[model samples]
Target: MVIINPTISTQPAALTRPAGPAPVLPADRVLNAVVLGERAQHLYELSSGSLRMMAESQTPLREGEQLQLRVLGKDAQQRPQLEILQRGTQDISPQLRNRLPEQLSLNQLSASLNQIRQGENPTLRQLIAPLLSSLPRRQQLSDSAGLQKALHNSGQSLEAKLASGEAPKGDIKAALLKLLATVQAQSPPPPKAGLARSYGPSNTPSPSVHAAGSAPADIATPGTASTAKSASAPQPQAASTAPAYQAPPKPLGLPGELQPQGRLPPSPPEIEGTLLSRLAHDVKGALARQDANQLLGLHSREHGGSYMIELPVRDRDGIDVWQFQFQPPRTERDHSHNERGSQHDTTQTGWTLSLSFDLPGLGAITARVTQQEKQLGIRFDAVQSDALELLRQHTPELHQRLAEKGIDVAGIDCRRRSAQALTESSYSLSALLRDQA
Candidate 1:
């Protein structure tokens, strides 16, 4: 009877209490930021050398522009340090004032409006950076004025840049914003998307008249195509549920419930081929004329000495058949190559060409044709396995050398080593002709 029960914990009461309802989030305020482009600006300074405003007020503005406007405090090095205060839109135009949507917070409106202030930006990038930053935050804003401001900023920036000698930056944000504003301002919002009845005098029908209960004769009024069609053609009885002004079941291609399906048929092959060929021809011409100077110009980075013809050989017909090749070798070795050689063996590469040209015609024509061959070599303690294989396949001597270095000749890719012994130990008949010349 004296044993204490160990069932209940001491903190049981604390764990039983209920938590309060989750806190509600505050509603987001609407914002509108104007779109703009970066551009150069002419700034005005007071006699004290404090930036008063931008010299050109026609350009779209940016946050950097405000920096340009502020008086700078001297730094430790006596360099000007920028300090900026936020600006509002009391000085903006009335049209823009009217365009500002009432739902936007004052801060949002001011921020948006200030982005397009004239004379503030020197570059479109500077002007539009703020607006571009705001796009990812669009859901936070609630009003159309922000949208309008963005549009106005973009349009003004584009116009100013165009008037200036500088090219347009083709900023997509500005373009889109201006386009949206133009559409909103020029095109009326679509009529509310429902059946709207216009009220008029009792004798006059509603603007959107419907005759749900009317007979065919009642439905088709005089001086109308419907009336004439009903009179001429035997018409099926209209559906009981359908109104007299049910828009005649919408003709083919009209937007309605009965939409045709399946994708459009393929274009004709002949027409497509002709168009493609014409386009190819046009592209060839354009490519041919494009940047003619670039074609003939030498690559600046690959500078080497020029090549010139020395002796010209002509045929019996007075036409030039061939010319001697001459190029002045570079006097100095590349410094970069010397550095690389410190770490690795410097590989020497060179090319030689064997050429013959034919001149067959009457006026001292010399018939010549040219063939070219190239050889490359590198000095290494051990060549790459792939290259060694090629050498072994080409030359037994190279394979034997590789074997001396403990490499297998049977595993090689080449027929044999590339080097060859002199043939007949004498120059060929063609070489003799060139030597004699």
Candidate 2:
């Protein structure tokens, strides 16, 4: 009886459960906005209801384009992150609408110039000749010798600037913008009946074809070739009576399972070796000058390309090594032609960075960070059991490291993966290691 009384306690031990982290409530709302300006890395400064916020986009948005954006929470800096749900039906300013086309043309011209400087397009004359010829007529620069001189001088100046390792000055850009705005104010010419054809159909045979046909006669009668040719040549004849042969149109699809069922492969990368070399040189120059904006431009060109950035740091093991590799967001090009005979391409932009190192007693670990517009993601891959346990025990250290590098790690996730994950694009490990050495 005494043993029973001792076994039965007076009060039961209180069962306590550990408290969980606080829940995050999503903030989603719709807002009317207009793009006011564009900055490096495709970030746009937008105006909405007494608020000015920065927004990132995969495609370039023209200034004054009305937008209906879904506000999807704020970033670490408290800037409202936006997701464009729809294009606004509200009318834009008449001046902006009128100048939009001219603005777009000018932007394309500027991009072409940059591509030429980067050596992406080796035949600069072929690309710039049309723009140069049309500029005088379209912008009314034919009579303004000073403006024409400025345009000509700007080309040489740009070359010199590139050679001297100087950032692109905005003077030429400002002049071009002003000229385009003025041109937009003027009335456009009335539509002609049709675009003039570069080559027209003709009944007359080409001189080369005629010579080919008369070659046998000349070879056979070298002594009397002139007289024979004169006698054999036709005199002012009507068009040939025979009709030209035409090939039948090909079928739209294959006979059976061979038919194409999905989207085509993306267009090839636009940035070749020459362009990459030029960009690398420019990036080094910018880095030497500590010009962050200029460095951003080299990586964030209109066309997608791969780049590598390394920062030296001491790891948890107290070993000095490169801590990070930055690959700026890039859009893959999917080119298509519209009914109007104009070419267009689609692009997708997302920023990615990776970190790799080995702990003193543990094995190798790699961390990948990706950000697409407003969303951010983190993944830990190729982790050993011991290292995984160690990382779980000291997870805060990873966050601190990222924060020190100016990366926001508030909403990031940490996980252990048995196998490494494949990226949309390769990480260029060889190139990165070579550069580090």
Top model by TM-score, which number? 2
Per-residue error (Å), model 2, residue 225:
67
For all predicted structures, in order, the TM-scores are: 0.14, 0.23
lDDT of 1: 0.25
Task: Give the per-residue lDDT of model 1 (tens digit) for 1-437.
Answer: 00001121111221222243311212221212221223233212211133121122222233222222232333343323222234233212121112211111111212222332222334433433443443322322224575344333322234445434345443323433443343234332222322111100112322212321111232321111333443685645433322221111111110000111111122222332222222222222212211111111111113342221111121222212121122222343434546446433344323311111222211111111111223222221112345444334555565566668664433323221211110011112222123323
In terms of lDDT, the best-performing candidate is 2
Model 2, global lDDT: 0.37
Predicted candidate 2: what Cα RMSD to the true structure?
Answer: 30.2
lDDT of the candidates, in the order given: 0.25, 0.37
Q: Taking the tens digit of each residue's C-alpha lDDT, what string does model 2 give over 77-115? A: 444455667764322223221221111111212233345
